[model samples]
Target: MTEGMGDKTEGAERILCDEGLRVAVGGLGDRVVVDVRDGTANRFWTDTSNLEKALHGEAVRIDAHGGYCVIEVREGTGRLDLVMEGVEHKHCDFSTGDLADAIAMVREQSDPEGSLVERA
Candidate 1:
């Protein structure tokens, strides 16, 4: 399980894993942004609406890298679980508040319009 770290943005907290993955959590409109990254690539698996559903105890699946990824937010805790199944299986857990600030950084560094589509 990942622990919450110091604040990384105005309303978000960030967590850095030793494997070089990062997660940031923050609000986006009425939904939450669970932004995950490996190096510079965003490996997010769900859209804002689906993320909201996950936060409400739903399991959401998305096609990814020729297979599929399952995303879910633990009930009442807001922790995110991402499980990728392809040639190999991978799992990541992001504590609540570890997926927000990166959205701001991504917005500022990339084209806002493109980021919108990327995050969607």
Candidate 2:
């Protein structure tokens, strides 16, 4: 979705208004990848297949601050759900914080116990 990423990066978009803080939702091969850009320009990537299934254009409750966010697929019509920490929920437009959290959740699921991070 960036200037040169192309369709290979479906569902990938920038979120959060803060400079250097953004996320890309897309896939490589058969795996979905969410790339997070922090304030320091450090990049963190996560795969969010589970989060994508929650449907888009609908309200999703995010755990952080009970914020409302919406999940939308890039270049597609699919939506998503945000079931955040502590079982809180938010429904609204796609956002940087929600995408960041989704990436974190996926990373946690993929690398429970820190094995993946250590191996990488």
TM-score of each: 0.44, 0.29
**What value does the lDDT take at residue 68 in candidate 2?**
23
What C-alpha lDDT do the candidate models reach, one value each?
Answer: 0.42, 0.36
Instruction: State each model's C-alpha RMSD to the native.
Output: 8.8, 12.0
Across residues 1-120, which tens digit of lDDT does each residue of candidate 1 receive?
111212122333345333434555443333233445544333443444565455457776654343444556574344433444422344566543333333343233433332223322
Clashes of each: 8, 17
Off by over 4 Å in 2: 1-20, 41-48, 56-119
Candidate 1 TM-score to native? 0.44
Give the worst 10-residue stretch by lDDT in candidate 2: 1-10
Candidate 2: tens digits of C-alpha lDDT, residues 32-78: 43333333222223224434443343333222222222345454333
